[model samples]
Target: MKRREFIGLVGGAAVWPLAAQGQQAATRVIGVLALESLPRTRASLAPAQRRLAEMGYVEGQNLAFEYRAADNQEDRLAALVGDLVQRRVSVIVAPAGPPIVAAKAATTSIPIIFFTGFDPVSSGFVASLNRPGGNATGISVLHTEVLAKRLELLRELVPRAKSVAYLRSSTNLVSDHDRIGKLQPAATALGVELLFVEASRPDDFEGAFAKIVSAKADAMLVSADAFMFSNQTALVDLAARHKIPAVYPSREFAARGGLASYGTNYPEAYRQLGDYLGRVLNGEKPENLPVQQVTTLQLVINMKTAKALGVAASPFLLARADEVIE
Candidate 1:
């Protein structure tokens, strides 16, 4: 038997028939705080549930979950996280930067597992990757440094493009600033001009697309964030209506008919988070677990979107893509 199973068996032997002793029952609860209500965020929660089940924790038995979403409103996050803390959850799982920030501010005693794209050290989320030294610990997708490579690929796919419009969320200003600082120097070296458009809210997408058109950008790149991911369909439709080729940071964007996307697989990251949570629940400290970095990045292209934009995806780019939605 595994260590946890052995301990459970031995403990149960000593505390046999606790009900006979009239002892009250206790259940462990985990709280999940998501930045927005989106399919991708919902999809990520399943693997975590599955992992917990494998570790002998069953929902409605000894394990329970409290799920809350900000519904794409940045202002609602603090309230939602506070609600979870007030409920006194044993552990909290936060996906995306904003929700994680809110959870960190809400409690220091409860363990927090986060999935973020920014560098946790630079963002001050932790002391170090190897030694988080606090209740917060999980995975970092390390997105800031990859901006140049993503831009290079966009340039490769559209060699004649002189100007590129970059869409970013105003709420994630820290990430946006870091991305621009890294992207501009590489863009200059490639002789390409980068125009930034801010889409702080869903209503801003239409205006952002119009700005892209006015800038006469040959293509566009969207910075990764939960807000953008949540409104992906609207962005895809807008790009299609405007006939502007675009690149995104997740395959889900391309799957929804965006031109192309390149980034780490998000669902797999959640699965890893589940494993880490299991360790923590089994008496391991968060500080002892090193923060994970995603190594598998996927390249995806949508043939239909490319055709609609009147651009043929180069054979070289197509060959390198992990998935091609036709």
Candidate 2:
């Protein structure tokens, strides 16, 4: 039998049902603050829930979940986070940077576990990676740090592209000077000019693509922002209608029919978030739990997308990709 099942069996033998039920105070209530659809938010959180269950946190029994989503509205996150805080959630589980920032501001005492692509320390989420020294701690990826690498991969996909259109979100703070600024030097080294396109909401995607097409850029690089990630279906559709070869921040983009994506395995990062959640629920402080770093990167390419875009895949590049959708 599983450890949790065995423990439950053994514990029930010693304590009466009503007496044991009084221990519900020890149950963990995970408040998932998100900036996307509730269904999508819950789906993304499945990995974390599974991991927590392995550590004996069964949803609706000894564990519970509270979900609040902004539905892609950046301005709504603060209010949503406030609701979670008002509920006195045991811990705040947020994905990406924006929600975490809101959750951090909403409550200083609640433990926060995040799955972000941006640097946590630099974003002011924690004091340091090795020692968080704060109530907020979790996992981060090579997101902003790997901007140039994604550019390099895009260049490989379109060798003769002289200029590339880059998407940036006005709502995400993590896309500040520290992160987006690296693109300048990267584009310089790759001999490609960057045509920056700014889009803060769903309505702006069409206009951004229009700017890219008007600029006559060879390709596009979608920024690694939560807002953009949540609204990627529309973004992906626009890229197709505009016929722009684009490189994305995660494998989900490629799976959704984008040309290419190079970045962290999000599910694994969420699993790490689960690991941290388990630790915090088990009486460990967030300050003592060092922030986990996402090291597993996936290079994903869709041959179908490549064929439709008329971009020939180099044998070397194809071989280097961790996954290719034929």
Candidate 3:
């Protein structure tokens, strides 16, 4: 090689390692705790990853994940949070209220970005939505706040739905109280009798459905809870087997062939959560970042499920749906 070329090559080689080292140093590890099953969690996070990429975060290049899923097991959350805490990830992103609550209990100093269904202040996850005033902050979807809307949709779907069944997990009593308190008045106003059923685990699903059948519920409204999301398939299947019309709080349920669903766009909420995570990684304090409320309510209808249940989706309802799965 020529002498000048040899010197140039040596200088280039010397600079490469420094650049790689700096890139490695800039990389951040994000810990994720999901209360839903792993497959659902991954599916929900696809948009979040894309949003992060759009914001200049590339996994394995500058961002890393330490992911843990509860797989419908609420008891596993604490251990998962402990593992993430031990790893000392740059930020913890928890989707769903249970895992977020567990993460909050596990650490007060770790920066946590959570995607929740209820108000953060009422849930005690944060001091306030405007200013978190603590280490935890993220998005809140109006799950409990929209119980009346879900009931309205159910009533619309089944015009003769004089008896409506409400299903939720038994583990979160506080959420149950909040949900029931909101649902009762709406049920009365709609002239529908509400039958409440609780399922703490997957095994309890069958029994809960049996109770709904016995109660002769014309339709069902499933609460927006992590356990319910985790067991969505079973719930949808059971509702079909019993030939009952059901409305869920997430689009995933309708996509999975449930009768209908109405609520905030959760994947969009997760995308916002990813954005907040990136901001925290860039040195924004969780306390300074206001908790975000997802406002884009989506209505999803499954024509196939409706037809199978012998229910007609009116032209008006179909036109109003954000998405209709055939």
* Highest TM-score model number: 2
| TM-score-better candidate, 1 vs 2 | 2
How many collisions between residues are there in candidate 2?
0
Winner of 1 and 3 under TM-score = 3
The C-alpha TM-scores of every prediction are: 0.89, 0.91, 0.90
Q: Which stretches of candidate 1 lie over 4 Å from their true place?
A: 1-26, 38-40, 172-175
- lDDT of candidate 3 over 165-235, digit per residue (tens): 88988655365577789889999999999998889789999999999998888999998888888888899
Cα distance off (Å), candidate 3, residue 132 = 0.8
Query: Per-residue CA lDDT of candidate 2, range 1-326, in tens?
Result: 99999999988886876676686776778899998788888888888889898988889888989888888776898898899888888889889788988888889998898888777877789999989987888888888778899999999999999999989886545446676688789899989998888987788888888889999999999988777787878988889988999999999899999999999898888877888898888889999988888888999999999999999999999999999999
- Badly placed stretches (over 4 Å) of model 2 are 1-23, 171-175
Which structure is stronger by lDDT: 1 or 2?
2
Q: Candidate 3 has which clashing residue pairs, if any? A: none
Count of clashing residue pairs in every prediction: 0, 0, 0
lDDT for position 196 in model 1: 88
Q: What is the model-wide C-alpha lDDT for candidate 1? A: 0.84
Error of 2 at 210 (Å): 0.7
